[model samples]
Target: MELLYNNSTNYFPIYYVKGKVINANIQTYGGSEKMTYGIGLGYYNEKGIFRGTGYNRVDLNSTMNVTPVNRLNVDLRLNASLSNRDRTSGDGTLQSASPVETVPGDPQELSSLLPGEGSVAWNAVLDALKGTKEKNRGVRLRTNFRLGYEPIDGLNISTSLAADYSIDRRNYFQPSYMSDDDYSKSVGETGINLMVLNENLVSYNRTFKEEHMVNFVAGFSYQYDQTEYNGGSAQNAPSDKIYYAPAGMPDLGIQESNGTKETIALKHYQSDMQEKTLLSYFARLEYGFRDKYLVSFSLRRDGSSTFGEDNRWGTFPSVAAGWTFSEESFVKDNLSWLSFGKIRASWGRSGMHFSQNYLALGIMNVGATPYRGQATIEPEWVRGLYNHDLSWEETDQYDFGLDLDLFNHRLGITLDYYYRYTDKLLTTIWLPGIHNGYSSQWRNAGAISNEGIEVMIKYDIFNREDLYWKISVNGARNWNRFEKSYDGKDFGGNIIGKPLNGIYALKTDGFINEQDEMKVFYNQQGVSNYLSNFYKGAFYKPGDYKFVDVNGDGTIGSGDAVYCGSALPIVSGGIVNEFRWKNFDLNMLMAYSLGRHIVNNLSKAVLTNGKYALMTDLNAISFWEKPGDHPDYPKLESDRMNSMWSYVDRDVEKVNYLKLKTLTVGYSFPKKWSRKAGIDELRVFVSGENLFTWTNYSGLDPETVDITSGFDLMSNYPLARKYTLGLTLKF
Candidate 1:
């Protein structure tokens, strides 16, 4: 029997930034006839207001291994975790103010105004934060058990079962003592998820003639998961003292216009649940010859309960091959600096599942229906038609790659090119109103193609006994377009031959000037008639935006709207550098993305329309005020009601940015110093994340785009900049 133990503790204490972490691990190993076991525990705590957020967590894990026979083994593992988090208010209202309200002025002047003692704006925000509170807590538990047997020398078999359970709870409360503009309410939500997975596998590995080797594995898996959520809320509480649901406020009842009075509902509740199951079978084979050539193939068949009976299963297969060029005698003899080189190619097929819970089998929903001019509430099928043959989206991909290592492997580079085509894309088929007024059916009748190239490079600059430095750079470029639609049609703003997230708008030819307002003419139509007929009678004086008539139809209309920009980035990359010298190390990462367009909704919402003119600082803008003022913006007006369509093209702007992702510096004490204190090693580090960003786009941040919707409305919480100083000791 043998025993082993390991432990570590980290502590950081700084003003407005403090954290602590402790971990313990233990293992017991026995001979083949005895059982082995291992256990671990971890605890972490953090508290900081300026740090944007804080959390505390505890984790525990245990594992046991048994070997009852010469060819059989069994292992069991369990893990549990608990965590709680606190976040700062990051909303527009006072109760959720983010970074406080900003006023237009110099930094020095703004600093002179203190909360409560100076400006009213500062005092209001401080009051709101003090009366609002939000909290989130979560718990997770997981367990796995596996049994393995090796009856023969070259063959092995294994079976495993695993289960996971998690629960998350959140509470948000705002007191009546908060500002008058804010609502007084309390809300709580709880979500629970459970999942079970079972798998069985068999593998065989053999080498023949000491030059050729082969390995194969086949597996079958089944997974099932269920999720449920419940929430409760109460609004218009009697006072700050009663913040939870079932708040008492009948004394302050609400009176209706019909001379009736009633108290608000003490508690309102909502709940939802969903379940999914999947079964899959997969196999893989790998072969290598002379340690220089390699080939691999894999296949998987999956069946999901979410799909219709006719299309419930999908097959995926992949094949890859590689050749080591550096292993050739001619190259090895001629170029000693080339340490290693390989070329590889691969082709694969995959499937995707989207947000269609019960689209394949239409659902009967409960809603209010009108019968005999009287509204009656009952259960009925939805208005839209259902498709019983909905299928999974399939994608086929091909890739070619090259890898190189030169100067004794000090420099390494990898390049890859890939093309992917997706067929049977899941989408809705819109139907004319004549059939069922604004109804649509789900179907798999869309196609898209995506291609990209990626390159990665790494080099060791300095390598010595006391100093070492290395740098890594990676970049990628991608292009995607819609290939086909069910009926060769466009939905919403999506168009064929264009990206899925492409924006459509009318082209703008700059603002109209005072001298050209009366002089300009459209096919014998004056400016006044053009504005009156096409612009919904909105007056456009000298400084309004001028649009190009794409159709030359004498008027501006929907037909003039064309593809203006896309939300997909053409290029993105990151650079990382690491340096070590005499027990000290430093690391930095910089990331960049370009060729993506955004609507700049934040600028259009807050910087213009003359709504918050004095309340917030606006972007640098120019307006046409006189005959010769030809500026980018229109004349400043308190109540300008221009057509939203007219500015759709102008609101779009390319977002290109470079950001310093992270910077860290650390130092480790010598072993001798730590050994004297009964410790194996000690390390201290300081790190900063999201230090700065350089961008031409005039929004909150370029990295805030949504992945599924491709929209950045600046409504969510802003990214936070964080700084941490920590020390670790291991024993």
Candidate 2:
């Protein structure tokens, strides 16, 4: 039996709240010469920091092992869980609102506002207080049975069957006070997913002369998965108290008022179902000689239902070899300091099919359309494009690695280099001109390559009965590029010879502060009508941003834009330190990333002297107020040119940051006290997550910034700092 409890508290920059978690689990086992069995039960409950949000779950698991006869065994396992979650409407909506709309102003002024006539902050508060309520309930079950037998010495056979099933239901209700149209709304949704797997395996292991060993294994597996979803929404309920069920809403029909007929669709419905299957056969072999040299090879053939029938099967193969140099007499005698050393290399090929079903088949959609001034259900003329040539995306990868241990095994190091090349990339491509009445079609096009190196080191500084300390550090760097594409055409930011998702923008010079500076800039090459043409006929004066003319004949056009940076990080790593003294332990982890850039869209919106509220940090001292006054930002302006200036090179900023990811301190009670209390063990711990960050970024949280588009739009919820105190007991 075990019990755990945790208390959590949120930190600054966001609303302060307290939450808690409780977990309890019990396990028991009994064994005999012929059979053994174990059973476990667990319960968990968590209260979120936000109001009206919580989760509760219960789990049950059982396992049994039986040896009916010599060299024959049977195993059975079953696991089930039921969970319920209370979701708040503010999760995605209210949190994404701008800080200016949620943060309050002067308390005295806010207190004077009238009912229903308050500021944006007051309105946001009201909506959160009377918003929609949502609940999600789910149930899951999984079972597995296996049988193993040894027909002869060094030979074994096994077979297993497993099945998993889960279902989820959601209930949502929004009262009239939370909607802009003064109408109540309700929605209900349910989804079911099922998966089944069967596998068989045979293995043979033998050693010859005690100097050579060989092992071989082969297996076959089949899996099937099915998913079904159905949901609907209704509006204009008779009362605000009705929740989840929409039966009280009006029916769908035609209504006439003042000689005008209108369709009344109080409810909307939707449903979908999909099924997929996979079949695989695999084999592996391993050989070793004198415990110094080792080699392994594996091959697998897989067939997936998500691809075209003709190209559904794919074969993948891999091989690896390792040499233990320390095992040799030369290394052991000469390099005594080297405790152990090994080098290994491997190459492998894999395939991916990551698309929905029926991509290779043309299909028509059925919907209601107006025919002769009356609604009719008919098949749409537009249909999906079919490409029987669709195939799986495949990748070939190579890896080389080195491992070393020194100083009596107190220090260890690992180094690895890897390269991957992928072709026949499954992607959506735009049609030339609406082929088959579709704007885009799925196709296998283009190729990409990624190469990187990683290094990790660990050292045990102290090892003693009373005190111990250990530290580990790891780092990695990667390079990604688009190698080829269909017809050498650039699509979706994938340009040949360039990093994927590269940032391209026009460069900018310093702001124009003095008349002489402006004149000198305009007098450069291609100088005629520079201000009037580039500024889009706006009132260009001192303190306006000046764009650089990259090309000799440049007029601030798209051609002047150049590749600036990439959204992917060039270097990332983490460091961890652990210490133990007596019955106390402490751990700290730090993570970092470098060479990543992000567009500060949030700052551009609020810092350009626009109608939007400005941050407290920006003031008159930050912007240019008069001629000959040098400042960090341009002059206050709301013109079109000023808006475009937000996209200039200045807006793109490096988001390199070093953050303290986690810190934990724990203490365990002595065995004497635990024995007296009739408990096996007891421990207490305190942990902090997202405790601190050191960065030059101007965004709220650098780690939360989206890397795909490299834009910090302020729509993401800021990462919260949490401190937890927990206690655990066992009996």
Top candidate (TM-score): 2
TM-score of each: 0.84, 0.87
| After superposition, candidate 2 runs with Cα above 4 Å error | 1-16, 88-124, 252-262, 368-383, 513-542, 551-558, 607-621, 629-632, 641-645
Candidate 1 Cα errors over 4 Å, as ranges: 1-38, 44-54, 87-125, 177-184, 235-238, 246-266, 369-384, 434-438, 515-528, 531-536, 607-616, 638-641, 644-651, 705-712
Worst 10 residues of 2 by lDDT: 1-10
lDDT of 2: 0.76
TM-score of model number 2:
0.87
Measured with C-alpha atoms, the lDDT of residue 640 in candidate 1 is 46
lDDT tens readout by residue for model 2, 470-525: 99999998888999987788777677888876787877777676655543234556
The whole-model lDDT of each prediction reads 0.72, 0.76
Candidate 1: tens digits of C-alpha lDDT, residues 1-731 = 11121111111111124333333333333444558887777777765433325677888888888988788989999999998776544321222323322211111122211332334645554455446666768899999999999999879999999999999877777786563423476777788999999999999999999889899999999998898888766667656766565634332334354666555454566788888888999999999998789999999999887778898899999999999989989999999999999999999999886554666766555356577887565422333455668888999999999999999999999999999999998876766665543356678878999999999999999988799999999999887888888888865556788777777777777776754453334444433344422654554556666766678765566778877677777789999999999999999999998888777654345434323222233445566677667665566665344543235687778788999999999999999999999988889899888899999976667887764344665544345577778777777
